[model samples]
Target chain A: MTNIIWGPMIVLYSFITGLVLGSYIISIAPTLFKMRNLEGISTFSMVTAWGFLLASPIPLVLELGSPLRAPNIYLYPTPSSVMALFGYIWIIFVLLLTTQIIIHSRYRDAAWFQRASTGISAIGLVISLIFGGYFGFIIGSMKAREVWSSTITPITTILSGITAGAALVALLAIITLRKDGLRKDALNSLGKLTLYFLAIYLVFTLIELSTTAYAETLTWTRLSILLIGYLALSFIGVQYILGGLIPIFMLATEKVRTSTIGSIVAFILILAGVYSYKWNLIIGGQQIVEVSPQLYSLLNFMPTQTEILATVGILSLSLFLYVLGLTIFPIPEFKSKR
Target chain B: MSKYLKLQEELPHIVGRYIDKKSAKPKWVMVVDLNRCVGCYACQVSCKMENGTPYEFFRTWVEVIERGKYPYLRRVFLPRLCNHCETPSCVPVCPVGATYKRDDGIVVIDYDRCIGCGYCIQACPYDARFRNPYTGTADKCDYCLHKIEEGEVPSCVINCMGGARIFGDINHPESIVSKMLAEKSVSVIKPETGNSPSVYYIGYEEAVKAGAPVTVINPKIGVVKEI
Candidate 1:
């Protein structure tokens, strides 16, 4: 049996990158769309996005067999390579985001900064969209893997990212914002955004699954085995029932959307759901062995101890950077200033 | 001298008669006669010894596929290696152009340049590539370019006990591969991929039919296992 080449590290890396794009969108939506509901937490969201962005490459580098040679991707880039293009895109996005954060934090009142911020936010939005879909494109382009080779893969990835990102922002906003500083309208808006995006993600996922099932090809057979066989609990039970349906129902109700505890529970579920989606896409896709009728034993693809450590370490690093940013940046007091 | 060396010595006249001078570069191709392959796995053993592929990793291997049931059961040996396609899927996905197709039509990796991200391994339709655990780089069969440059056939071709493998420059119309292509009905794997693989197989349809239950046997221990 051919062992899975890309494993859990790839899944985590994709998830973190999605979060980076999602948080960045939430940060800039206030300025770009003039959504005053997100205004209070805009700077906080940008900082969160920046922190995750800074930490995103850690898992990717750690996953490489020769980590020291990663710079070769930049030096000897093949233009035709989507992965090579991702390197350039990541650098450009990072620079744009950093510049936006600097301007928004330090020079918010300057007329020049405002104009530059608007232009940068517009560009950043496009880049984040690409960044969100980048991992999906990587998987989708591999024609050998039937489950991953779908036109809807990138769209589902972007929607999941937005849902997870909004949930993360909501969860953090509750934790960091002073009780008096917390605005009901902002939380409700974030809850509503998460609900809409999560619902869209669910619809696209169902469409992808149904389309795969509709075909009489080997794809459906393998996917059916995946859905009802070994991965049933993770793919259907957790990802759909607990993470997807429960959260959607919770967020849809005003009683749950307006309450701190209820919204927090829903956001946490959304985050878990998104992570499960990435897990299913990366690990579950690899489980369907192309050459053989038998699925690759999931036991083979379980993250090694080193992989698990690296995932935890990188997640901790992202959280550390976020906390550090909170301490270092002079984020204006949201209640009084905004 | 090997038969390939003898053929190489006669290449000038062959090229003069068959190939245009401007396009005379050797385009290597392999033709596997499934009819002749007896599942001896001499090629698989020789490849391991020659290339020093890491444990549990293969540069070339044969898959033993059994079809039908009970009285009608039959086994087919499907020998697999890199197709070294005219348009390779693995080539364009490399973040660092560490893997590329040579003008001679062999797909090769620059080991020193590879970061071992395994993207090429994932992109390959045939599962022909692997990340070398010891070297920490992507490695695969390159038609044994080192041997070929010295006017020798790949180790696998030379060691195939059943004479099932034919390796030659298709650019020379007089080459064995050209004659075989002209004489036999052949098929390439995953033609829908648009990779234009250089490797050709006789009896490909019967041996590699989709949904055929496959069993990979380890030649070393003669163990039958489903992979």
Candidate 2:
């Protein structure tokens, strides 16, 4: 009998890492690009990235059969595996984000600190881009799983991160800082940006599906399981229709883009869509059951009680840390700046 | 007897004189004669008893493929296990180097070192590896290494009802595996994967072609029998 090796925890890890990367990319807007309208949410998004980054590896550790032995990946790393690079990459990210957050909070008024923060942000920008896309590269490198083994996978992951990141920042701005003069114009601009990234993600997904349809041998069977088999409802309904198309339509119209409830609905849909994509890609790829040369079956995998509880616990911890960061740090007051 | 048979009998005697010295390492290989396999599943049962592998998880298993229509129906038994490849895909992907190949070409896992990340399980194209729920490490066929170390044949080889499985050192010219390699044409599964599998098959063309996507053959289309 065939059993699934990777579970929903892997999907959660990938999704959370993408959010950290995407949020960091959004944070770069005001610091590097000098987008004044984005300046209010810039520091807030950086804190979001930090909160999510701290929570990111928790899922990976929980998923391991032996959590203590995880450090062995660093101690006896094999160069051929991309997973081996994770230890070093994660440490570097922690150092850089810590320095960036310290500089922004302590010395925003000092010229030297401003210059130093800019330099650090530039480096942070480069690291975020690589780490964000590398999440996709991790799966894309697995040549055995045809649905995940695509050049488009990494690019799609990075784009989806940006879409999710923008939605998150918009959601936070509306919810927490709405009375602080976080304006409709700023949220509208962010909405427009989210719409564009969401559109590109949809296009990349289409291209991925089209090319996958022609894959030979075992890959063809995998794709068949995805498109026509058990995953059909989530793949078609939740991902394409509710997540992609509806959000795009809502964000396309100016009235809905500017309206508070409309923008919230669109961002929420984008988040759901991206999360669904991660689930379908990582978990769906492992669900293809090949018993022998001629025999193939599909195994059903849903998050168990332990898995769901662990995921929810990690995310709730991240949200708690984010709120703590907001209170302790000097996040720019939207109304004071206005 | 053939010249090779004479050599097979005499070589052990010649080698006995050098008992003080370390003997040559065996480069193990197995040959599965598809023509002789009778779908008895004795190998499957013997392997499980030998390994004590958990229920529903097998170190080796039997797969039966039914082909063609009612009057022309054919049932083929394909015994499946790890290829123990020369370049096993599962080896490099192991983050902790827990899985490695031996000097004699047997792929093994260091149970103590495996972190049970399950990467190797997915890397294998043959569907040969599995996550052992008990140990939480990757597990697969090792060609009955423990039994071989005791100078005994693999359980499946000895227990095979059809006498289909042949095991020996392929590097020795007089060995049964080597002789069969010279005398009979053989094929390996998924040759395009470039794994250079050691297990060779005879009359596996139909079995190889059966990899095309499975379809629902109508119940009335194939040969039917009442229980």
Candidate 3:
């Protein structure tokens, strides 16, 4: 029997990594572009990215059949392997982020440090963009799974990541920013960014699905399974309706965008939508068996209790670290001069 | 000297006696005659016993592909294993350089070095590789390398009751595999993958194309009752 090798753990890892990449972009973009509205949450976004980044690899390590042997990726580097590139990319990105955070916190007034931080932020932005779309490349390179082997997968991933990242930063900004410090325009900017990205993601997804359906190739059967079969609820219902349409509708309206509770609900739904999209991409991709026309039994796709616990546990640890970081680090007030 | 070291020293001489000296390196290949496969799964059972493959995992297995309908119904036994392709998709995608092709043309996994990332597993279009539960490493048929080094055929080849499985060095022009490949019309599974698989089948297209809704029978339980 064919089993789904990369399951819920992989889905969780991909989702978290997307968030880390997206948040890193949100953290660095304001200073680089000099967006006044986003500047207030720049440092806070960097801290948030750091928290998620630290915990991102946990699920991946835990998912490995031999966790201790993970270091072998670096030890016996396969230069040709796309997966081998992850270690190098991740380490470089982490170092860049750390240096930028340290410079901003400790050497904020130093002329050299300011220049250094800006240089680092520019480099980090490119790396974050790569990191955001890298997971999609991992899935895209797998020529076997038709659903994931599309050229558009990486673009969709980056767009969805940006959408989720903007939502998360907006949510946190609303919760943490003082009444005097908080900017309605800043939240509105984030909302507008999210709407645009989410719209693009939907368009790209529609193009992919429509083309696959029209092709009538071997991929069509698999696409059918995702569209109207076992994964239909998760793919269409959660990813599109609850996650995509509801949030887009809510964010589109000025009343909901300005209201505190309305924005919170929309952001939460967008996060859920992004998570569901990842789940469908990773877990759903593996559901189709290679040799047979038959899809893998639904029973095989269910995550084990350990997998559920590990996913929840890792997320909890990341949130804890983020909270602790906010308290430990001296984050300058939103209105403080740069 | 260690047994492996001693064996390594003696191996060339042992193989040289049986294999032609003109062909310095043996390019191993298998030819599966689908017409001769009797659906007896002796290769499947012997493979498990020989390799100690984990339950629900296989180094080699027989797939019963049901073709046609009504009076014309036929079950084609397609024996599946790692093709050890000329350009293996699994090799390039391995994060750790654990899986590689030997000079003699066998794709083997270095278990000690494998980190079990499952990237190679995903890259392989054949669905040949699997995670060895015991070793926590990628495992697949290596043409039974230990047996080959000692101048013996793979367990699947020797145990195949129908004599459908043929293993030999294609580099040697006189080898049975080379002769069959030259004389008979043979095909490889999923040639579209561009893996250029070493395992060639004699009647693949006719058997596979004459069907729809292909289902895989469990290799362990060889029984499939006629509908």
Candidate 4:
């Protein structure tokens, strides 16, 4: 194993793959909701699945493991294997979702399209929830890292995904809602949805910490590391207090809800909160050692510059891909028409 | 002349009875004599060089810890490796079944099959498994199987300045390890884990500290406690 080569490439691939998949969890809900108000939901689903298809699969091909002896996640998939389940879900759903969306969009006024869109969107939501929950459990299965071993991880990840998806949808709404001259009811309803997801985020965070206390699993050093070093506070700060609470508080009164710039600010803060929440979870969980006397570093564990650069590149690609999707997809046109 | 010839014929058969049973549940074991070990790190260097492990990934390494502060102090050199237990926790949880115990009681890792997901590294209670940053798969001491194939002791055992680590099959009564276990009171690390580890240490209490409490009261955290 010390052997021939295939170290740096694998590490980079793991990092890039993680970034893309982690971000996809956030994109699931909004794409589903874009059915009637924008394109049919199936249209969005096809594009979303295709977007992941474009983004997530490239890294897998670059993996260092022997091509001959490679795991049959794709070809001869084990039914119980999580990765295989996701792969199958993506292929089948994306195809069905895409076909239905295109068909429905062509007949936007038809009764069948409307009902089918709703049904497909609901199915997509379930799939996304599974995707979200599995992402966290993947890390939690690493029993060596006590930080990542918590049962609360799966819930937290799903909560984060839904809330972040809402934020993205809300951002798009700001651009679209303006042209539509959307009244208080639509804004209020959407704002309420965002606030509810934010509340879920808070509950998930609390549950994670509370479980740690009950188990006495987290070391004092690790607890302090999570609190002081990173944006553990910011996850709650921007996502809940400023992004969710303050926006809801202001919108409840009436006049502040009308301020376009204030809504934009809320969008920005929510975006920041969601991104940093994921960043903290990934980076902070890794900072602590899993075993006694440590494994990554007998001396000191630090990420190399190459690893950091590769992470930035993958992140940039994810954002770039999202923008690419928004630019090409017809949903933005619906916003313009509105 | 007839009696002598008969005895010679039976001697090979008697010895062959245990040795030929290589498939018959080989109970791999090691006995460490702390009374003989000085604080020298010869075993650590030899194991590292033999394994070609990257700096931190020690298949077998020695730790010299000082106890009883003051004018009177004692330092003990304890060499550690994968204990190769019968019920290793690291085995079952591996998603790929890359790390597993062979029929011969060896905890072997098939690097070819390892996905380098590092699940096994985290599950090991003894902190024995190391994920080679270079290879991405879990790397560990294999009890120097290559040396055993060559009919020689493991590098650490062969290079031991003090004859501390005695490696052999414990099932055979005539083996050095089996005889040592019979003669000396040997103990495995954290026996309560139910791993039934092969590695045994004599005079462990005298050489090592009365290890971090048995009951795990309050389950103290961040104190650099041994697992």
In TM-score terms, candidate 2 sits at: 0.89
Candidate 4 lDDT by residue in tens digits, A70-187: 4534544444444446556556645654554455445666768657766665675566556556656655655545667788887777676666555554555566446655444545
On DockQ, the stronger of 3 and 4 is 3
Off by over 4 Å in 2: A216-228, A291-295, A333-338, B1-23, B210-227
Which residue runs of candidate 3 sit more than 4 Å off their true CA positions?
A: A112-114, A178-180, A218-220, A293-299, A334-338, B1-22, B211-227
Cα deviation of A27, candidate 2, in Å? 0.6
Best by the DockQ measure: 1
Question: What lDDT does candidate 1 reach at residue B150?
Answer: 69
* Ten contiguous residues minimizing lDDT sum, candidate 2 chain B: B218-227
TM-score, first chain, each model: 0.94, 0.93, 0.92, 0.69
Error of 4 at B180 (Å): 5.0
Give the runs in model 1 whose Cα sits over 4 Å from its true position. A217-220, A292-299, A334-338, B1-24, B209-227
In model 3, what lDDT does residue B146 have? 85
Q: Looking at model 1 chain A, report the run of 10 residues with the lowest lDDT sum.
A: A291-300
Is model 4 an incorrect, acceptable, medium or high docking prediction? Answer: incorrect
Candidate 2 has an interface RMSD (Å) of 6.8
Give one digit per residue, the lDDT tens place, for model 4 in B140-196.
Answer: 888888766655567787677778888777777777787888888888876866778
Q: Rate the local accuracy (lDDT) of all candidates.
A: 0.82, 0.79, 0.80, 0.57
* DockQ value for model 3: 0.41
All predictions: root-mean-square deviation over Cα?
4.5, 5.7, 4.9, 7.3
Q: Candidate 4: what lDDT?
A: 0.57
Better-scoring candidate (TM-score), 1 or 2: 1
Report the lDDT tens digits of candidate 2 across residue range A1-338: 46677788888888888888878877878778887677767788888888888888889887887777888888887887767777778889988987787777777788797678788889998788777788688677776665567888899989988888888878877887888877777787788888999999999988877776665534555666666878977788778888999999999998998888998999899888998898888888777654445344566787799998998999899888778877777776632743
